[model samples]
Every structure is written in C-alpha cells, then in structure tokens.
Target: MDIQKSKQLPKILIITTGGTITMTPDSTGGVVPTLTGNDLVRSVPDIAKYCECEVISFVSKPGASLNWVDLLGLAKLLNEKLADDSIHGAIVVQGTDTIEETAFIFDLLIQSDKPLVVTGAMRSAMMLSADGPANLLAAVIIASSNMQSQGTLVALNNEFHAARYVQKSHTGHLHAFSSPACGPLGCVLEDKICQFVKIERKSPLAMPKNEIASVGIIKAALADDDRLLKNIPALGYQGIVIEAMGAGHLPAHYAPYISEFSNKFPVVLASRVPSGPIFTHSYNFAGSEMDSIRRGAIPSGLLGSVKSRLLLTILLSLNYSPEQIKTEFHERTEY
Candidate 1:
C-alpha cells in the first residue's frame, strides 16, 4: 500500500495488470509491460489528492493474454474487497485491447454498488505523449466520487463510458474508446466527474460453480464457409457466439449448421455492426435473427460478439440447459 496523502480521503484499490499503460520500450526496441501497480500510482501522484489508494499488482500480461479465469479471479477479488464497508471503490488498470470486455464482465458479476472503473492507455508509457497517467488519474477520481451504482465504467481520453455500450473504436488513436449506439455515461474534466447519462445496471450474476468454460466467437464474412464453425464443437467448445453479418444474418448455407450446433450447444447471434440492436423480426431469410432463434439459437439483443461470448461461457459453466440459457440470455440482453 502506498498512501502519500491525507488519511481522511476515501480509500480505493488500484488493481494493475499488464497493458500498454504499464509498458515501456524494451531492449528489443518493442514495448513490454514492466511497471507495477505502485509504479503506475506514482506516475499520477495527483490521484492521492482524491483518495488514499492501495496498489495491488494483479498480473503483468497484455490484455489480449488475459483469459476467462483471470476475469473470474479479478471479479472475485473485487467482490470480496468491496464487500468491506471501509473500501469505497476500485479501479482496474489493464490493456485497452480487452478493457471493454473486462468492464462488461465485471458489470455483470460485481455485486457491490460502489463505483467500479476500468481504464488503460492506447500508447505505451515510452510513447512521446503517453496518456496512461492522465487516464489513471481520471479513473481514480471517478472512483472516489459519487459515481456509485452506475455499473462498470471505462475511463479513457477523459471520457467515462458504460460497459455495455463502450468499445475500442480505433487501434492507435488517443481517443480510442467510444460508446457507439449509446453515448458516454460521463467524463472527467477539471478534476470533476460529470455524468451525462444513466444506464440500468445489470443484476450481478451469481458466481458459477465452475469457473472455467470454453466458448468460441466466429465472425461471418462474405464467402466464408462453416468449416471453422463445425470445428468449434469438435474442439470441445461448450458454447458459441456467431458474429453474424449485418443485423444478425448468416448465409443461407449456414441455416443447417446453425440448427445442428444449437442443438448440441448454446448459439448466440450477435450483429457484426458496431452499434444497434439485433433485429428480432421482419426478416424472412433462412439465416435471419428470428430464424436463428427459432432454430434454438439465442439473440444477443444489443450485445456484440465479444461480450456475448463471456455471457455464454458463464451460462454454460452454470450448466444451464439450452432452454434455460435462452430465457436467461433474453432477460439479460433486454433493456
């Protein structure tokens, strides 16, 4: 624990993971994660003015390398920590590549009403104008504010976005994270957290008896065949999220495979488009969203492929039957 400020300030846990934010130029002329939680906090000593922070180096790996078990473990740790009345909130620092998914997973599973924020930088700390320190400062400021019960938030580029709608819009831009369909929930400016939207937070999912499950997400492209789709179940995947083409429609040839897969494992239909709800009706095509659901696949509603996979994995880990999974999936996806 590194507290360089007044004890009267609210306390927030700073959980750091390896990401671009913690990376530095390595001897091989490439950026690598080499900073600890304490190092990151020290970079933004101004955060101490907002809250007394506890630094915990959770892991030192790129966000893309973080797996389902890492997410489960992080959520468990946050839940246990926030359950203590003395702890105000927590901020998770990791790579931006997976920040949206991490935020959404924590949004679904973290029961604490205290504010929970996830943030990372688009550039490495060695970059000329690295944004990690500013982002980290913004996140901790939000955590110390009255942003309670607002669900998981992604803070970057001085903006705060809800977990459900926020996504990585660009690869290298400083303003990489954005909530497409829905605008950002808030922003940090002049050291103040200002919110512009209010979203209905998801009811926290119960901790699964099994913390591990395999789910694959396949994006449908033009002329793509079902060879990869067929191999998913053969590879022993427990569930699937198909990033179907516009409005959740696959090729006519996929209709049969959809039926075959949905019969054995849960199939979730999410749109390839960045923002919008999955169409529930009005399409008569063989592989339309309605057709897929009729064939036992579930609709992802407004969720994209990345998030649907996480939700489906949790459902499968719970041993949910296809029908039961359908019911829960629909309820959770609905606004």
Candidate 2:
C-alpha cells in the first residue's frame, strides 16, 4: 500500500486485471496484457486530482478468459479491503468483454455500499487517442464520490451504468458499454461525479462455498433445432438458460426438449433480445412464454441470457434447490 502524501484526499483502491487498458502492441502487432496496477495509476496523470489511489495488480487476463475462481477472488478482495473505514471505494480496471458480467457478479457479492466502479478501454494503450487513462481518471472520481448504495457500476466514456442493466453494445466502439434496459445511473463531468438515478440493489449474496456450478446457455436462432439442448444434463450441467426467441419462445418442436430440461435441471427461460423485459403473459403460442412456463420453465424477467446464465450459475453453486432457484430468479428478474 502506498502511503498517502496528503491526509485529506479520498483514498481509493485501483485494482487492475488484464484488458486493453493494461495492454500495448506486441512484436506481432497484437495487444496483450502488459501493465500492472501501479502502471495504470501512473498512466492517468489527472487521477491524483480526484483521489489518493492504491494499486493492486490482481491478475492479467482477458475478460473472456476469466473464470469463477478469478471472479470470486475479486469479490473477496473488494469485500475485504472495503471493510476499512479509511478506504472510500474501489475501482476495478479490466477488459471490456466481460465487465457487464463481472460487474453484476460483484454487485451481488460485495456487501458494502461503497462505490465500486469497473472501467476498461476499447482501444489499446499504444493506439492514438487511447481512452484508458481518461476512463481510469473518471473511475477514480466516481470511486471517491458518494454513491449512496447504487450497487456495482460500469464507468466508461464518462458515464456510470448500473451493473444489472449494462452491456457491451459494440465490440470496439469507445462508447461500447451501455445499459439498454435502463440508462446509466450518472456520469462524470469536470472531475466531479454527477448523480441522476438510484438503483435499489438486491440483498448481497454469500460467497459460495462451491466456487462453480455447471451451467449452459442455448440461444434460439432462426430455425434453431436446439439440438444441443438435450446434452446439458448428460454433460453434467446443473442449470440451463434457454435464450428463447422473442420474449420466451422456442420453436414449437422444442417443447419436448424444454420439458426434458425442466424435468432434469433448473431451466430458466430468458429472452434473446436486449433492452426489454421477458414477456410472460403476452404470447400463447405452442412454445411461447406462458407455454414454456406451463411446461415447467422459469421465466427470467428483464434479465437476458448472459446475466441469466451467471445468476443461475451462482445460485446453483450455493446449492439452491430447483424450487428455491425459481423463487430467487423470479425475485431478481422483476427488480
């Protein structure tokens, strides 16, 4: 831990994992994880203007490569460090690919209301107009400010999004991350944290004794036979999230598969589309939302496939029964 030069600055912990924010081009022209937490802290020249920062170079891996073990370890870090009264907040810097997922996971796992902001860059550090430093500075500002218990948040492009609602809309756009279902909670302007909305986070979950539980997702595409659906249980998956067409519909032929999965595992019916609630009563076709429910599928309201899979995985890891899992999903899906 770096000793603070001044006693008055808000103390923020800037934990770094691997992402574009920490990467530079290699000899082969590919970007790789290269920067440490202290390195990132130095790259942002104006960050000191916002807060007194400490760096934890946690891990250096692409967001897509991170597993439950790494993720749970991150949660443990945040929960432990934030328990300190002097620490104002934590800023998690990593790759953009899985920020939405990790942010939501942290939102559920972190017990404290202290501001926890996850930020990353779309462009590599060597690229012209790299956004990492600016984003990091913004994250520092947000971490130092009063968030008033808004759950975990994604701070990028000067905007702060609620973790539950944020997603990576574009693969490489500077403004790639957004909360389509609900807009950002706020943004940073002129080194100040601006406030707009407040999200009532659900009760924090316990760190699972079992770090992982097998879960799978199958998105319903055009003419998708969903042939892979039957293999979930045989492959030892404890939970299945069907990314059904529309609100919650597979092809009419998928009825048997849905029934089979529901009978064997906790099946969550989530929507493939973004930005809308999973409709439960709007449709009544053979494989519609209500029909799926009639066939014993649990509806994931508002939660899309990715978040649904993460939630199911966490619940299963906690050893929740099918009925208990259904109740939890129902509760989380609504709010």
Candidate 3:
C-alpha cells in the first residue's frame, strides 16, 4: 500500500512491541508475534489518510514478559522521539496483558504534553475478527489529533481511557479495557474524536538513574502463611505491595510479620477486591488495615496492587525514605 505524501497531516510514530495484535499462528498451533511495525501499518491502509505514519519495530515479546527495565527503555526512547519538532505524538502497540501497568509507567515517566496512546488486541491478528487494525487506526487518530488532553492514554474499542484508571477487566471480550472508578476520558464517535473529561496533568517524575528497584506483590489468602512476608527483604526486594482481603485485612496470625516486614522496607497495602479504596478505620482486628497502617505500612487508597507496586518501585528507585514514601502515597492516593 502506498501512502500519499502530505504536508498538512500530522506525523505520528507507531512503536510496535509484540502482543496479540501482532501475532500469527505458528506450526505448533500456538500464536507468536511475527508482524513487524511496517506489517501492522500495511495491514491498516486507512490510517495513512489520518497521519503521516512512521513505524519502529521495538521488541517482539508478550507484554506479560516485559519488566521495569523494558518500560524505562521505552519511555526514554519515546522522550527522544517526541522531542523532535516534526513528530506530533506516539502510539505504542503492545500486548493487553500488561497494558495498564505499562501505560501507567509511561504516564509517570513521560514529560511530553503531546498525546501518547496505547492500543492492543485481545485476539491474534490472524483471527477471524481480529481487532488490531481498527484499534491501531483509532490510536493513530488520537495520537495525531489535537485532543487537548495530555499524558498517556489507552484507546481501545473506540473508547479512550486515561492510563491512570484503565484496567483489563475481561479475558477474551473485545471491550476488555475499562476505567472502573473514573469511567472513560472520551470516545471516538463517527470517526471524530470527542473528549468529555479534561484531566489535569501532573508534573512528571524524574526517571530513575539506577537500575529499577526490585518490587514484589503478594495477595493475602485464607489462612495465608507469613513466611513469604518474613523473607521478602532477605530476597532482595526493595519494596512490596500486599493485596489484602476486604478493606485490607490479612490473616490475624500474620500481623506481627507484617509489622516486622514494614520496618525493613516500604510496604504498601491495597485491597484485593477491585474498585475500592482501602479502609483505615473500619476494622480493629489483629491483622486489620488500621493495624497494618500503625505498623508503618502505607495504604493505597484507590490504587490496585499492580499500580501500587509500580508507585512504590518508582519511589524506591528515586531513593525516597520510608517516611517520604508514605507522604507521597498519601498525596497520590488521597484523591
């Protein structure tokens, strides 16, 4: 397919990282990412009409396999490209498994006010009803449009969600990504971009200079053992987020170990249940939310465990003290 050269159209960069969106069936009956960025661009010829697109084949791995180092490298590359006066915005195509985390990390690290949109498909590109092309087209449109909003966003299923609130709610549905508490920032209607909410952009955090901090997450279960908690610091983790039971309660027997762990490193408590803030005063049991807070554990109000872990990792990488980390969490999660 040939794209007509036009000076009036905005230039957008499509950075392809492997996901179901770029996958094809292998001989083993499993899907593998075999499409390059140019292949994706060629598949959706209509996107050429909206923007002067350029393709960059960044990596070819599932999103779930990506780690903090990968995200940091992507963010740095984006910063360099978006700084160019000719490039208007960028679109990241990756696997949906970790879109929420990757997008949030990008939102935190990127300093550009230009739109950054992330999109992926639930089905492989070779599937009967593959959603990659349409999603990529929509993402390119959003990235090139003068949508007043600034920061990283997820554009999927014709809807745009702020990276801070978007989550993967379903496993196989086309409309898997959703903003549970804040709803979507906008939608694409009749090929026109429309934004309903105007979010205030926060100052970007300084990218970590050292290797990204090691952070781990643990979900509290019925009759959970506390040995994991006791060994977290010894295992070389700088921080950890605990997904506790309702309102952030652990097994009563784990209270002492929780206290012991918090004393060694930053410990954040988030609710295992989706879509709610952690309660601080509701319960007074031996291993309750309040009890954890009193033991120097920070509460992740409305943030999920995954996000909480990201925040803690960033803060620890920046060398924030435990007290300072608690203060930052209060400022961020209080809303």
Candidate 4:
C-alpha cells in the first residue's frame, strides 16, 4: 500500500452525485447540495497522496428524485471515463436511499474490468462526527488497490459489499449498509484491504433504448382487494412486481385477479421477507406461492421487491418475450 512504490500511480476518478455527504445548511434551516467534487477532495487531502485524482460534479439531487434517464446518463459517463487507458478505476458518490438500485444498474451497464465503488453518508457534512470523509477515503483506497476486475462495490463503514447483494437496512446509522444473503466481500484496515470472499462477474447488459417501459409495484396486504390490480392494464403499466405476503401468497380473493392480470402482462411474485427466497412449494392453498406460479406468476427467487421491479422494467424495455423473461428469472434465481 505504498503510493511511491511504482513510478506512476494509478489514476482514479471520483464522480460526485449529490447526497447527504455533500449537502450544507441553507438560509431556511434546511440543507441542500452545494458542495462540489473539489470541496469533497479538499476535505480529505490524504487521498491525493494515494493516487492521482480527478473529480466531476455530475448531479445535485436527492436519490429518490433520480429516475431511469438520470441513471442511463450516469452509466454512459462512467463507461466513457473507464474506457480511458490512463484511468484505472472510478468511484461514485450518491445518496444512500437509492444506492442499491443505482449500483446494480452500474453493475449491469459497465463492461470494464477496472473496479467501480459507490459510497455515501447518512449524516450531513455539517453534522457532528460527519462520516463522509472517512467513507470517501475508504472508497478511494479500494478503487486504487489491485482489486480490479471485480464487479461494482459499495464501500461504507470500512466494509466493502458487492453491488448485487448490498442494501440499506437502517435509516439513521453510520453502518446502514449490509448484505443479508451474502456477507461483505472485504474490509479496509488501517493500511491494507482484506478480501474474504470472491465474486463471479456477470455479462454486461446492452444499453436500454430511450423509450423505456413503465413498471409498477404493489404490496399485498391482509385484506387487500383487486380493484387496483384490475386497473393496472388499463392504466398503461407494462410490468408489475407484487410484494406478496409470507412465502409469497395473496388472499384467496386475489387469486383470480392475479391469474387474470398475469395472463395480460408480466407479474412477478416476490416475498415480503427481508432475507429469503420466494417459496416454491411450501404452501398449496388457493393463494399460495405454488398456486401463483401455476397461474403464471413468475417467482423472483431471492431478489427483493425493488430489485425485481428494476429487472422487470429493464427486461420489458429491451423487448424480451414472456418465455425469455421466465427463463431469465429461473437462471438468475438458481442457487
């Protein structure tokens, strides 16, 4: 971990997208994204000694407000920068609210072997004991290391998590990100990076067209009716993800409506539980998981509702047929 060991150190790019990490107090007692990429680098001067750095202030908005178009643009920018022969790796700073989705999208779009890391903070930069500088330093260290060729990563609280498995489990804490199904890939020590597990990379997906399909998500409740479900097709929704109840079951009254909806459009059934796969044959009631599958509801194995919605949206936008979509779900969810 000596910066002066090699004649030419690795060059890293830090792409800044506004989040709590870059927000400052405004006149009305609220905070806004006023800090630029240069400001962040100035806060932590140690990063410059580790690697040659370049900064780009991409966007300044909350993660919830970011849509598909914004993500597409960010992916394209990252691809262009990583394609450069001198740029060894890149780090993305964005809001934690949508990091899971954005990181997964980057994982799908970026085809380069160079490492890409995403980091953010729960507390604002002006708060006491702000965690932004530390998190950003760790991310830069990971990006500059010899861990190239690994897939996208989320670095926070000194832990490195794979983009496919990481999630924000807590609302207010320094250690909010975690990988429930799979543990973190590594941890950043004082002067070294330790990797405990290795992850296999998947093939990159083609860039989606401008006209992406509209997708919706619905969470099944105890006594939920089918009024909204029945109106989705008429409302112009191309795909849907149902956050079904335990073991991925709906009420008996919803079974017929689910079958009817599935026949018209792609309906995915995912469990509401946090860290488990959708059950295939645990129950056999009229509205059980097996029944839904029998009625053409595709099971979203271990993917949560949010991730399932994104996958369905991308697949439908790319014009994948129903059978091809089903096969993809099977292949991705296979343990």
Candidate 5:
C-alpha cells in the first residue's frame, strides 16, 4: 500500500460519516458496520497512494440514522474546509440510504469550487472482491482532477453525478447510483479525466446564521392527511418539502394547509415519482400547482423531496422572499 508520498499530490480531506464502505463482519456472521476514520483509511490503503488524504472522523452512524443534526454539523464543518486553501478538495464517505439528502444539503450550503465529492461503498469491506476501495480511490481522483472547481459532485461505481440528481437504486450492488431523469455530468477512467458537463460559478452564498434547532422531511402519499401538516408549523419546523404526486399535486386534503403555510415559511413541492422534475399545475385541481404557486409554495422542478428540502432550508436561512426563492431555484438548475 506504500507509494511515494509527495507534497505535490493533491490534498483531499476525506470525511468519514460511516456507511457500508466502512462496515465489516461481526462474530455472528452478520455484517457489523463499525469503523472509525482511521479504520476506514486502513481498510482502503489505496487512498495513501492517491493524495495527501486527511481523514476527518465524525460519528460513524449508518446513513439511515443520520439526522438533521448530523447534516448541519457536517455542512458547517465542510464550510470550514472550504475556507482552507491548503485543502484542494473534500470527500464524504457515507451509506447510500440517506447520502443523497446529506450531499444535496451540503451542495446548497457550501459553495466550493474545489471538488467536494461524496462517495460510499455498496458492498462491505469484508465481502469477497468488495467495491469500497475502488469507489474511494475513484472519488479522490475526481476531487483532485482539473475539474475541482466545479460544484459539488458525488462519485460512486465509477460514475460522476451532480448533487441535484443522484439517487440510490438498489440495496446491494456495484451500479446502485443513478441520475434518473438526467445522465451523469461525467465519468471517471483509470488515470484519466472525462467531463461531459459544464457549471458556471455564481457568487458564493454564505451559510445562514439563523437559529434553526432542527429540520425534518415529509413525503406526500396517496391519501396524505393534513394531520402532519396541521402540526408542522406549530412544531416549529423551519421548513418542509412535500413529495407531491405527478407534477407536484398534493392530496386535495393538503391544499388548504399548503395555502396556509406558504405564507409562513418555506414550503417546497417535489414529485413522488422519480424520473422527471416536479412541475407546477400538471393537473387541473381547483387548488392545483398554479394555485399553490400563487400562494407562494416553491416548486422544486426536477429536484426530489430530499434535495428540495435541503435547498429550501438554505433559502429559508438566507431570509429569501418567496419570489426570490423561486427564481433562485430555477436559476441553479443545469437540467
């Protein structure tokens, strides 16, 4: 695992937040997913050959257990890394279950031209011919490449995806990550770089200084009742993203509540269906997407509920007016 250590190798800060890539087998034959930051480095020895990798160990919680508190902590820390010029790029190794949500949130909060790539292994390190090391090595390479200044990206199974569109497609497989409605921005080849997309950097948005204690996600259902919606505002939620039906239609029961909350804080509407972005007013309900738009509910075109929630939190933190939020969301898209 020893390779020449040169200062010229790109400095990559590998943030370990725990996922299958760090997991190993326990005594009972079941996979035991417990690994610290150093353990992750030891397991993936190839990283040493790639760059000046610094392992930042956060709580090694499985991705499913990552809460909003963990997300905020990660975002704040990444923002700190962004300010460090010596750190050329950053990498977050996490489980796939909630990786997209975390990555999407980081994308909105931290504006870094340095490649901030997040990756995770679909297979365990203990498995025969595991994929963890390969994915980890590939991510570091992408982060250190000439395209480092591009916006936040996620690399898994050799594919490079923008934070906005990547999703986990299977529980256990090498090719589990997909962009769904859009193809990857690029791909990684051995010792070479390939980019198929371009991103224009806008003025960096500062992280909000609001006193947001917590935030959570809610998805729209077939007959979603207003019980949850009725309590969310009073529960002191700074924001909520609704996984609305096709083209962002909520259950008829939610229309009144949607109208009610659109005035209070940021309420974003995304699609439950996976492939396309959530459009406004695809259906002709009385309080349809058009009505919601008039009332100031944000339409998350193409961004799913998780990503929408992430962006909405940022917009809310920035104290963006409803009109400003809508325009910014639309402007940030490369789809």
Candidate 6:
C-alpha cells in the first residue's frame, strides 16, 4: 500500500447500485440490502481515508432483479459522472447476482479512459463475518489507482476481472466471482491493485440500424412455448437474441420462429449456460447451429444474450448495418 499521505488521491465517485455491501440487519433479524449512500460511506470508513470520494447513488434496490430500464438509467448516470473532469474514476457497489451483467452493459455503452470499477460483497455488513469492507476498500483502491484507468472491471474477493468475462459463481462463498474462459485482468493485493492482463482494447462498438431493435431472451425447456418469437417483431423490435441451449441449439419446434425472426430482424443466437462462446456447426440438426447461421441469424460470437443485447442496442442506436453490428459486436473494447 502507498503509505505517503502527501500523495494526492484520485477523485472517485462511489455510485451505489444497491447490494449486500449496503444492507444491514433489520429489527426482525431478517437481512435486507437497503442502506443509503450516506450509510454506505459510514460502513467503510477506510474508504474516506484512502482517497477523495464523492458518492452518487442511483438505486437502493437489490441488483438481482435488474431490468432494461434500470440498465438504461444507470448508463445515463455513468455518462454524466464521467463527464466531470475532476472525477478520476467511479465505483458501483451492486448486487452480486447481476453485477457482472450490469458491468458488461456499461462496458458496451460507455467509452472512456476514466476507470469504472464495479464491486460487491457476498455477506452483508450486519453479518457476523462480513466481506463488504474489504471488497469496498479494494474497489476504492482500484478506482483511485492508475492501473485500471480504462475499461470496466470487477473487484471482488481480491480478484480483478474484466467486466465482460466475470461471473458470480457461488451463492455464499467469499470468492463468488470468477472469469471462466479469461482470467482476471487484475488482482487486489492488500490495499493495492496489481494488473496482470490487458485484453480490452479498441473503440466502443456502434449500435445497429433498426426501426425498432430489442433484445429478447428465451430459455430452453422440454415443452417450450416460443410465443415470444411470434409476438416480438410486432412489438416494434427489429432485432432478436435467443438464449439457446447447449452449443446454441434450439428446440425442433422453435425452428420456424428462428426462421421467421431471421427473415425480419438481425437475429443473434447465444448460449444460456455459462462459459464458452456460441459457435455455429457445433451441432448437426436441420435447424441446428449450422442452420441458424445459414439463415439470416448471426451468432453472438463470445458474448451472452445480455451483452449481445447491449451491443445490439448501442449499434442499433447508432444506425449500424447488419454486417456492421456483427463485426462491431466483437470489436475490441478499450478504455
């Protein structure tokens, strides 16, 4: 840890997106993550000691049930925060359940050199053994440090991960978050951030051109009802993203819907399960990965449906072409 108090600390804004880190025990003994921005500061006094921090909290709700509106709102706030020249970086303390997803979205939307770090605790502050302070401290350090001045990162349980690859693996373990295919971009040691990788590099991807483009996610099931496929195009959406089965396989009954959506919109397919990119020609059915790609539909490449949707939204917002959307979706994301 840098011990000199004379060194000027970077101005970091801790945006509270709500999570276990802010939660405390209620009178009834039930745990709820409802602490406000002020309460968050008090929980981790070490943060104030580290650097100059100005907090701007958006939501006090759980991060598990995040919706599209929440993501859009958060992106707007992040854009405003980065606009300030005095702000060196920002930290978002969010629920572990959707923190990775949210961070991935922010990475897709925001293109800045000012670091954006997302951190959360597995245990609540009111718990007997809490990890909130450590995680929060790590986040503050990562945000203030010159190491990760660009790109979206997750600082959790002493591990630093790229926002795109990180995932919350365990429900209760301190080391809940992990980057499956890709290792961590950096790691937190004591109170310092040590960077080991630099994968994200390039300008942000542009949104695709669509009259109305929306990302629609559907899970696989034995008796799946793809009424969503029939209903989506009519709902003013021009793009479709299906969270297909293992290796990007959709049920035989749902083939028509894929064909139908592909004809109308830029349909992108992804895997519902964790790890691995969705690749075509992995399966051999008539309308398998091969057929899906042979049709107008495009594969999500490496990103899941959520990230794919985010990239699609950005590209669509910028009026990018179908080929452009496919290419930009995999564009190297840099700070």
- Report the C-alpha lDDT of model 2 over 1-335, residue by residue, as the tens digit: 46365778899988988998889888999999998888878776677776788789999999889888899999998999999998899999999999999999998889999999999999988899999999988888888887748889899999999998999999888989888777988888877877788878888888898758888888888887555765666788888888887778788987877788788888889888876887788888888888889888999988888999999999888988888898888888794
- The TM-score values for the models, in the order shown, are 0.96, 0.97, 0.95, 0.95, 0.87, 0.86
For model 4 the TM-score comes to 0.95
Candidate number that wins on lDDT, 2 or 3: 3
Give the runs in model 5 whose Cα sits over 4 Å from its true position: 1-4, 201-203, 213-218, 223-234, 281-283, 333-335
Clashes per model (N, Cα, C within 3 A): 0, 0, 0, 0, 3, 8
Clashes of 4: 0
Q: What is the C-alpha lDDT of each candidate?
A: 0.88, 0.87, 0.87, 0.87, 0.76, 0.75
Pick by lDDT: 1 or 3, better one:
1
Supply candidate 4's per-residue lDDT for 295: 93
Question: Which scores higher on lDDT, 4 or 5?
Answer: 4
Instruction: Record all residue pairs in model 5 with backbone atoms less than 3 Å apart, i.e. clashing.
Output: 113-149, 277-302, 278-302
How does model 4 fare in lDDT? 0.87
The parts of candidate 2 lying over 4 Å away from their true place are 1-3
Tens digits of lDDT, candidate 3, 1-335: 23556888898988989999999999998999999998999998788788888788899999899877688889999999988988889999999999999999988889888889999999998899899998988898899899634679999999999888889999999999988878999988877899888677666788899877888999899977777766776788888898998889988877887788887888899988878789988888798998989887899988899999998999899998888888888877776
lDDT of 1 at 209: 67
Report clash pairs, candidate 6: 206-315, 207-314, 207-315, 207-316, 208-315, 208-316, 209-320, 212-238
| Model 4, span 23-114: residue lDDT tens | 99999979788898888988987887678887888988877778888899988899999999988899999988999999988887887879
**lDDT by residue for model 5 over 1-335, one digit each (tens)?**
12337888888888888888888888887765687767776766667667887778887878899876787788889888877988888889898888777777777778677788889888888888888888888887888777755667888878888777788877777888888866788887875668787655444566777754344577777755667877888888876777777777766777777778877767777778877876664566754777676667777777777677667677777787767877887876535
